[model samples]
Structure formats: C-alpha cells, structure tokens
Target chain A: MNITSYTARAPQLVQALEALAQRADNQDSASTLFHELSGITVLVAKKFTNDRTADGMHDAFHLTVGCISLGISQAGIADSNEAKLSFLLQHGAEYVFQMGFRHIKELSALPYAAYVSDFDNDAFIQQRNLKAIFLEICNADPVSVWTGDAVYQNELLDRKRNRKIIDCAKWLRKNNSNGLVKDSELDANAAISIAVIFAVSGDGCIVARTGQRELENLIARARETRPDVEVNWNDFLKKIPPEFQPILRERMEELRGTIVKKIFSKTKIKTVLTELQDHYAGSEQDIDYS
Target chain B: MSENINLPAIRQQVTELVLAGSPEHAEDAINETAEKFGDLAVVEVLNTLEPHVASLHLSAFDGGKMSLATLLIPPKAWAESLAYFAATWDEDWIEDEPEVLAESLFAHIHGVVFGTDDEERRAELLNEALATDWGTTAFAVLFSTAAEEIIEIANDIHNLGAHRSGRTTSDHDVIPLVLEIARTNEEAWDRVLFEIFPDWKPGENELHTRSEDDGDDHEDEEEREHEYAIGRTTKELLLRLRKQVPSKSSGPAKTGGRPSLGEDIFS
Candidate 1:
C-alpha cells in the first residue's frame, strides 16, 4: 500500500486503540484492546518488513509503540490501582529484559565482538555501539526521566562488567601457549580481575585499570614459565593469527554489516551518499585509478 | 396468441435481469418461473438450463450471510461451475462485491474458512490454499472483507472516546454491535484471540502429531518426534541458505558498477 493508504488506515487503528483504553471495564475489555492493538502492530510490522527500505529508527519507532501498548495493557489490568501498578512495574521490568531487550539484541544484528569493541573506531562502529552508548548515557543521569534513571545506572555497571570479562578472555587467549583456555578458568580469572578493577576505580571510572594490570601480570607470568614464548597484547589486538583471523574477521564483519544494513538501509543513507559523490565529483581523490 | 417466446431469448432476458444490478428483478424472475412450472421438475429444468445464473444467485445469497456452509459447494462442482461461468459469461457479469464473495467462499470451505468447527478439514484447506493460486485469490478476498470490519472497529473506538470523561453511554448501547460484528468477522475474532491469549497455537496438530500413530499410547512420543522433525527442518533450511552464499566479489570492477552499498544493505 502507498503512504496515503497507510496514513488513512493508521488513524482508524489508533482510534480503535484509544476507544479501547477509555472503555476498558474488565479483564476481557482490556484483553480485547490488547488484541486490537496487536493486530495493528502486526500489520505495521508486516508493512515495515515488506518495505525493504525501512530504517532502524522506523523499526524502533514501531517497536516502541508495541512496547508502550503492552505497558498500557498491563496498566489496564491493574485498574489504575497503586498495588496493581507496583506489580505491573515489576512485571514490566521482567518483560523489558525477557522480551524487549532480547528482541532488540537479536534484531540489532550486532557482531558479538563489536558489542565489546571500542566505540571510537569508525562511523559504523559508532552506530554499532548504540546499545553500549545508550547504557552509558542513561547511566549519566543527564535526564531526570524515571525510566532512564532506573535503567542507566544498572546497565552502565552491567556493561562495564561485561566488557572486563570480554577483555580478560581476549587477553588469556593471546597469552595461552595453545591459544585455548578452559572456559571455567577463563570465567574465574575474568571475574577476579573485574572485581579488583571495580574496587580500585569505583563506579565513575570509564577505563578499568586494575583489570588491564592483572591481565598484563598474568601474561608476564605465562611468558616467564616458557622463556621462548612471546606474549604481546598489541600484536594480538592488531593482527589475528593468520589461520584464524580471516575467518573470524569475515564472520565479525558479516554480523556487523548485517546490523548496519538493518539500521541504515532504509534511512537517508542513499541521499547522503549521493550528495557526497556529487560534492566530490571532479576532485582528484574522487577517481582512484590505482 | 402466445407464439411461445424463444427459450434462448428468454434465458438471455433472465441473465440480463440477474446482471442488471437489480436483485429485485432477479428474484422476481426466479419466483415467476417457479410459479409457472408449479413443480420441482421445472425447478430442476431451470437449474440445468441456466446453471450460471443459478450459481450467481447462490453466490449472492451466500455472500449476504457470510456463511461458509452454503458457499463451499464441492470442489469439483465449484471448479466446473465457476469455470463454465467464466468461459460462457462476459467479465462484466461478475459483481465487484469482493467482501461478499470472499465471506461466502471462506464460510463454505470446510477447513480454511471457519477454522473452529472442522479443524482437520481447515488445516487441509489452509494447506491447499497455500499450495495453489486459489489460495492467493482467497487471501485477497479475505483481506478486502477484513478492511470493512476494521473500519467498523475504528468507528466503535471513536464512540468509546466520546463516552469517556463523564459522558457515559449505557454499556448496553455498545455491547450488541461490537459482539455481533466480532462474531461475524473471523478476522476480528482472531484478533481477539491473539490479544487475550498471545501464546495460543491454532493448528497444533501438524506441529504435534505424527503420521504413523493412531493411538494415545504413542501420543507423547509422537509430539516429541514432530518437534524434533520441525527443528531439523528449520536447521536444514538455514544451512541450505548459508551454503548457497557465493564468494564475495573482490571490488567494484567485479561488480561492474560503483559499490553503491544502498541496494546491498537491505536485501
């Protein structure tokens, strides 16, 4: 359907939802409202899916609406009572993690490594780092919004914890003789290092210094035992082992690319790219013969 | 002095009456003929002689009720009769009432139309519809019918807005209309089902049952087997798609165009 058709139908569906919210008298009425809203949501989802060019923001907007409706349904069930509202609040938290967060993570198509990747690398990296950035921003308490205040603090701590573990795993893999560490041992080591780092730096520190120090000391200990062994974090970071790097890089790139495609594919990227080309049309750098 | 009007001419007149956008004229013609013949024999003769016209009337009546029981006439009969009508009659003879036609057809079909009654039949019909062009046609018809129901729902929603904030309408004013509409429109009912109980699976038989079992003894085993079978099928499909990916082109030269990235990003 054309945009006009969508615009025309959307109001009708929205109106139905509003009606439902107003007249919600019992569980069934609330349930009916939920069902009607869901149908509209599904229709919107299908349209977005079929559009082939719908961007991440568009998809997110649709998801947000669905999420809000779900919240409203819960509220309706609670009958606007404080006791029920408290129950709903707890339920909403669980729903956010179980359904909302999980779905966003899955739909994000973020590379496993990129989730831990430093945010300053490239434009794509910046975009891919939204979840982490959002967590950090939310934690900063820049806005006094209740949801943000509640979420940011927890997410910020969780992300830091998560990042330390990832870094520790990478460090162990780099220093290990066979480039393989026992999963349990890796987890224990990472946990210890993360705890030490958090204790030393407090919650406000952006970088985890103690974790890096512990990781370096561990590598030094491994190198001392095997004198001929080489352990270099820089080398490990800069170049993956020839045998594994290409495959791992390709996989990581694929995942990262999928996320970027999902997000920007339907946005203003086309027009932006076209404008860039036009601006550089006759420049010496525009045509790279080499 | 009745020189006996030519039978074909009479039939043609009847066809025109049926197609003239006048339900009254068509009803009158049928009633007049029945009166003239005064017997079931005449009725049978009329049906045989003007089968297309008769089917049209039948279709109209079925559409009006949105009743599947009347519409699903046997597949062989449906195909033969519809095909004959299409071949013999002009395109203009078919009415543009998509909502009516779809409701009638869907209601009549044992399985696909009314899924609650004969579930096994409904599944078979769903499978058949998905497997054939008729399925697509049926979907289009259903979608059109759904569109009208959706509008009515929108209206109800608007009325609810007016009722809120100390402007109360008697609850009874809203009950019958919404309930009746929901009852008649399968789409609305399905929406209600999905909303109230999001996790309910409609066609669990295919996903749960096995071909070999006929007894309750193997029921649990059958369910597990089918679950495994579905999981395996899903894995195979994913693996097959992965395997089909070709080696990536090295650069723009291989692509024979600038690496646009726009088209590559989405699909």
Candidate 2:
C-alpha cells in the first residue's frame, strides 16, 4: 500500500484497538487487546518504513504511538481505553516531539530535494510546536530537551541543586529531628517526591507548597501514572529465599541509615544532630525546640 | 499397495534425480510410487527431497536483482511440473495434512520457475501459475500462495531477531511481486487481504462513530481528533483497494504509478 493508504488505515487500526480495549473486562483479555494494538502499530511502522515519503520524521509519529502504547501497557496501567489513551497522549506526545527534534541533526544531511515538497512546512511546524508545548507542559526545572551546550550546562546545575534538595529532605525524614513532626509537615524527600510525581504526571510544574487538596491531586496523578508503584514487602520477602531475606533486609536498612547520616551531616539540619550529640555527651541540658 | 516397495530407497533415487538436474525423472519416480501407495506417502518423501535440492542451489534473485537465465528446466517443464502437484493436492486432505506438502510443492515450482533467471520472465511464469485452474473439488490452490511466503518472512522476523537475518534487500522488493499475483483478479486480492487482515470489512469505515464521553482533558480531545484523521486516511486506502486496479496485467516493474520517492536505502 502507498503512504496515502497507510495514512488512511492507521486511524481505523487505532479505533479497532480502542473498541477491543473497551470490551476487555479481564487481565487476559486486556493483555490480548494491548498485544493486538501493539501489532497494528508495528505493522503501521513497517508500512511507514516502506513508504517513499518517510524521512524518519513521519516515522516518529508512529514510533511514538508504538513506544507509548507498549510503555503504558508494560507499566501496568489500567486496561480501560480511556486510561490508556490519557496516558499515551500525555506521555507519548512529548516523546514524539523529542524524537522528532532529535532527528533534525540527522535530517541536516539530506539534500533539499529529499524534502516532501507537497507537505509544505506543516508537518515541520507541527513538530516544532509540539516541542515547545512539551517544554511548557513539563515545566521541568532541568529540561531534558536537547539544546546547545549552554542550556545543557544550566540543566546540569539545576539537576545538582535538585539532588542536594532531595538529600536534605531524605535526612529530615530519617532523623525526625524536628521533634514530634506532624503528617502535615513534608520534609525534603516528600517535596522532591511530589516534584518527581508532577514531572512524570505531565501536570506542568510542581507547586511551591502542597496543601491537603493539592497533595490529594498529586496522589491521584501518581496513581494514574504509576498504578503498580507499590511493592508488597511481605510477598517480596516470601519470594526471596529465607536465608537471604534477613541479610537482604539488614543490608537495606544499613544502606538507608548510612545515607541518612551522610545527608544529615551535609545539610543545615546538622545542628539538630549536634544538639542530640551534645545532650548524649552530658555537655548541655535538653532544650525542646518544638 | 505393498510394504515391499522399499519407499526409502525410492525416495533416495528421486532425491538423486532432482540433484542431478533430472526433475522430470524425479517427478516420474514420485508418480510411480504414488500409484503404488498414495499421493500422501509420495508427497512425504518428496517433501524430504526438496530440502536436499534447496541446499544444492541459491535463491533465484540476488539482492532483488534478477540474474541471467539459470533455470535447469525449460518453461514447459515448469508448467507441467506445477500442474502435476496442483492436480494431486487433495481437497479434504488440506485440513488434515501439515501445510508442508503444499509449501514444498510451491517451493519446487518457484525453484524451477525462478531458474529461468530473468526476473520479468520469472514474474510471467508466476502470473501463469496464479491463473491456473485447479479442479472443482480443490480449494483455490493459489489463493494464499504468495501470501504464504509473506507469512513465512513475517514468521522469520518474529522468531529470529530481524537484524540477525543479515538480509541485503528489504522484503518489499518481493512483496510487490506477490501482491501483483494476489491482485490478479478481485477474488485473489480479496482472499489475500482477508488472510492479512481478517476483521477488515467494507462497512467498517461507516460503522465507526465519534467516541462519546470525551475525557475532561484537552490532550484526550486532541488525540481523538488525530485518530479520526487516521481513520479517514485508511478509508481512502480501503476505497482504492475496493476499486481494484488490475495488478499483473502490466510490466515487470510493478511501479503502479507510485512516483519514485527517492533512493531506497536498501538499494
């Protein structure tokens, strides 16, 4: 079939998948639906490659659909077509744009004659707009888009800052050094977790402070993005051989403790550690800070 | 029918006949054996003989380019040989037998026909085979003929990693030829397309309605719109196929009026 035919056929393939997904009520059926949808996408990709007009840019659209659909299903997202569509559109759009922009470097080699002249610049314009929209929608502190060296350097700095913030937050949670901390008070780890949650959820930027209602929204968003996020420790331990489980758990605990101590030492919260040490050493009377 | 026929020795004689470039002798040996036993036993033995022959030679085309005349048998011999197998293929037996017998017969036909060594000439022979009439009791023998090869390629890709095959040319080069055969008449195209996409129907385009309960997000709405556009695009392709331009009626190039988009990287 020609590109025109493939272009016509892709939608019905997607619709058929949608119908199948809508009808699926169990895991096996949902898996089958996802498998068929993936197959259709793969076939479309194969046809796109066969198409003479495909410059790897047109391929990005189908590749995105294939990757995102596969990712959502593999990520154990809900089988409902609505949920799958929501995740795919939210995540896959940026991926498509990112892949498109990434290809521009390779595309620079092609002669002007290679361009699909009849397509004009509409596809190119749409791709450019998608990248811009991806950035706007993500509102990520350290944008992952491939820009020139200067922006990359700044992104590195931003990432370093985030790492430092996360370390401090993790320390605060472990030390519980704030004295009778309330559930309402989020430490550095919770704040960074919320930020990562928003970054993944495609919900623009993380707000400065998460109120009760805002935290609830973030939780809901996290649930949508990572439905299988929870790891059952008991079931996990049962799977691990009995002899290895205790050692593994002990090593994990030790690792956590060591990281907390290191973070506490580096952070401003080190003063709380100093106070506790001083009281233990009989150098000063206990002073309640909270 | 006698157990004293010593089928293994007979099969070896046939194998040597095919290897020695006496496919006619090999076929005669098979026929004489089939008369004693049945077509199934002869076919089973012939099935083993094909692999021996295949190992002795290469495929007809190299990197999608047709080589000069390489066929051992004449064009008439190829026609006669294919007709023999087509006539012997039992209608009721198809369901019970492994498709291997049919596959082996077609492979033998292709092996001999492609030997003519000219791509265009080989294509013509293929066209003839596709048009050949099997007896009324038999299934459309050539219905899934070309598609079966395409399915083989698909299966290979599925089993082995695509890159591991170390193929020099894309399957598209051969696909056009198969499609040409498949599209000889509307029935042929219909059968091939049905095998490829079973759920496809003429009315499916009209049956699809706009999805209700659009999610409360802008992204969902945009994706839905894109999907609608894709459906419309596929509808055009389906309509074009429905119109059915004759496939093999023309030249060997099978260009089908699609402009040369650019240099194929595979080339």
The clash count of every prediction, one per candidate, is: 6, 7
- Against the native chain B, each candidate's TM-score is 0.30, 0.32
Distance from true position, residue B112, model 2, in Å?
Answer: 20
Per-candidate DockQ versus the true complex? Answer: 0.01, 0.01
Worst 10 residues of 1 chain B by lDDT: B229-238
Error of 2 at B236 (Å): 24
Q: What pairs collide in candidate 2? A: A8-B233, A8-B234, A9-B234, A11-B231, A169-A188, A169-A189, B71-B115
DockQ of 2: 0.01
Q: Worst ten-residue run, lDDT, model 1 chain A? A: A137-146
What ranges in model 1 sit over 4 Å off?
A: A1-36, A40-160, A176-180, A188-290, B1-267
Q: After superposition, how far is residue A105 of candidate 2 from its true place, in Å?
A: 21
RMSD of 2: 28.6
- Best candidate, TM-score-wise? 1
> What's the TM-score of every candidate structure?
0.21, 0.20
Q: lDDT by residue for model 2 over A145-255, one digit each (tens)?
A: 212222323443554544455443333334332333233333343433322322333433322223334433544444445522213233433433454445334433543
